[model samples]
Target: MTAGPAEALHSWMPHSPCGAWCLPTGDALPKVSPARRALRLATLVAVVLTGPLCALTLSVLGPRGRAAVIRGWFRMVLGALGVRLRVYRPGALSLAPEERERPRDRGVLVVGNHSSWLDIVALNALQPVRMLAKAQVRHWPLIGALAARAGTFFVDRPRLSTLPATVAEVAGALRGGAAVGVFPEGTTWCGQATGRWKRAAFQAAIDAGVPARPVALRFVVDEQCTTAAGFLGEETLLTALLRTAALRGLVIEASVLPLVSPEGHDRRSMAAAAEAAVTEALGQPEAEHAVPEVAAAA
Candidate 1:
């Protein structure tokens, strides 16, 4: 019997070459005490419980008011997780303050590297853009509820045939002057390595005639880069959350690079350009950036 698109998609799911080997284990990583971890977890739950109230409050606010509330909520989420966030605009550093703030109002396609669930929190904290999330994320506990309320675009990976429609939906949102976030790698990896970019999401930018903005995300602990926060391999989400909560002095650096125009570029070239921009911002040598051949096949 021939396999259906759903079955084929299950088999075609992207996988990273990064695993336990890419992460720091045992004494090599700095950790907070069990008591501290418990405190962080409790605080996180408290903050999440306020999501419904926040959503209700947001419905009555104007655009500026809504953005303010969303930013505060996401910042509180990062604080609850005991993670520090630092946002940098490498491309706009030389520009005047007013010039640097201009892009915030534009509808651009935001693309970036994915390493942990924190990536979502950190990016949304920077600005309340609609993110492209896997369909399963829409069913997660409190997190899923918050994502749905925040206008996240959920992609059904199993329904591979629906991709064009998904892209069209995203394009329509972009055309309406909303920034859409996507991780074209389509899978999470340890911060030490990354996967190849998939071109499907980039098509939305081309279709909407919007620029693609590449952002680089890095997780640092105790002044050194670490993959302790990564949700990789067979690790459960609970395990990853606990691990992140226990880490001391963890900082997530998000660098916003210059935008890549979709004009005169096809989806493949546009995706490659965005990937190259992110890779450069990450400061990794070309050889150090890992692209699993298996992921490309997927």
Candidate 2:
């Protein structure tokens, strides 16, 4: 018998018990040492106090200079959190002849898995991007002001009526040669399993007719999956921040997966394809969220 859409995809989407909220069932996380905690606290304080000054300087630089500033800030923030970032394109050392000649100027829509707030810093460390953030982030303490100054787009998710405008803004940004980063999951999930990719962000890629780049983020501590990095459940921002700051040997590995062209597909299909790409890159079984047509095509 042939498998149904969900079942066929489920065969590939294995759950990682250690991905989210490492607890009784999954591998437990290590306790943070007092000395390390104090060190991290000092680092955070320094970054927080100096970040705005850096942003102010960034405002005066040209586009290339601004990108440099963003990358530098990302590196600084990751260092403060004690999370090392490793970024590499898959099979980059062995590119095909045809791919070698492929155009590198494609305006990108970066769609990635969302687990921790640290994802933003880790990803930006690899490449500077205009991030689409929730409206509440505009009010976040020091980072909020810096993010706005650096041109982060804010969205009001609860209001369905505002989506068209947001999509248009994202498309405009892409058309003007700006790369945008969006978390397609719409909400945080324990790193164990990625949730469905919301179709809203994909619409921007569709409208701009650009490649939707899939990025997969994996957070590890001592070479093991760490739940201490996830910002899920009832965890408040402060709680999550404190937990991440206290973590030692945290490493974020970001894999830039294959790009999904939006030429022939609608928003839902594009989202499903991007989701599958990210899941596969993360070593999870291939899965499509609520897009049966995509599964059928596969």
Candidate 3:
């Protein structure tokens, strides 16, 4: 018997091949004094504790005001974690004046490669967008509550039947003129390597008739790329947090690539184009050992 759409999708969910082995080792990994790390962690806790107040304040603000507040809060979070952010917008500037401003006028599907949890914080620091996150994140401590308040769409990866509904919800939000962010690479990887685009979220952009804005994220320490910030394999959230906090001089560079039009392109083709753009922006060739889709379940 032929399997249904959701069933077929379940058979091909994307998973990263990267594990603990991908992390930086020995002298390659930068470290801060223990006291500095503790201070950073304490600052992060204090900032997170202010989230509820921020959420309350957002209730009274207009859209633009709320966006400004959210961006400020995210920047604070990044600062507390000792991560500096640098954004490059060559693509936005390269567009015609009106075209460049169109993103603000209409809904846009923001797509990017996934590397670390910090990627979400960095993206929101740049611009407030409703993110598509795994359902597990919805149950995470304080952060989960904040994400829900920020309008995150949570997808339960293990629930095959719910895939279609999740896509529909994302498309609906896009159609309502909200910028929705999705990491087409369904799972996170070490910053040094990235996985293939899964294509499900790309379909939402096609259905909503919006352009796909491709963004690239890179983590650097001491002017060199580093994977110490990655949350993968058997790593726990606390371990990742401590690891990230212990790293000094970490910089997150976000590059906004050219917008991809959905005109005359199917979801698969659109996904491929966006993936290629991000790959080029990161200056890394596509992974030669990208685990096959069929083997993703393993």
**Number of the top TM-score candidate:** 3
True lDDT of residue 11, candidate 1: 50
Kindly list the per-residue Cα lDDT of model 3 for residues 179-270, writing each as its tens digit. 99998888788867777788988889899998888988888887778888888866677888888988888888777777898898999999
For residues 213-246, could you state the per-residue lDDT of candidate 1 as single tens digits?
Answer: 8889888777677888888776678888888888
What overall lDDT goes with each candidate model? 0.79, 0.72, 0.80
Predicted candidate 2 versus true structure: per-residue lDDT over 1-298, tens digit per residue: 0112232233222222323234223235565688888887788788768878878888688877877777877787777777787665665446566442224455789889988888888768777889998776899887789889878998865555787999999998887777899987766677776677778878898888887878888887777765567876555777788777766677787777667888889998899998887887777422222111110000
Task: State the TM-score for model 3.
Answer: 0.89
Query: Which prediction has the highest lDDT against the true structure?
Result: 3
Q: What is the TM-score of each candidate against the true structure?
A: 0.88, 0.82, 0.89
Point out the higher-scoring one by lDDT: 1 or 2.
Answer: 1
Candidate 1's displacement at residue 30, Å, is 1.9
Better of 2 and 3 by lDDT: 3
Off by over 4 Å in 1: 1-12, 95-105, 284-298
What are the RMSD figures for all models against the true structure? 7.1, 9.6, 7.9
Q: Could you give the candidate ranking by TM-score, starting with the highest?
A: 3, 1, 2
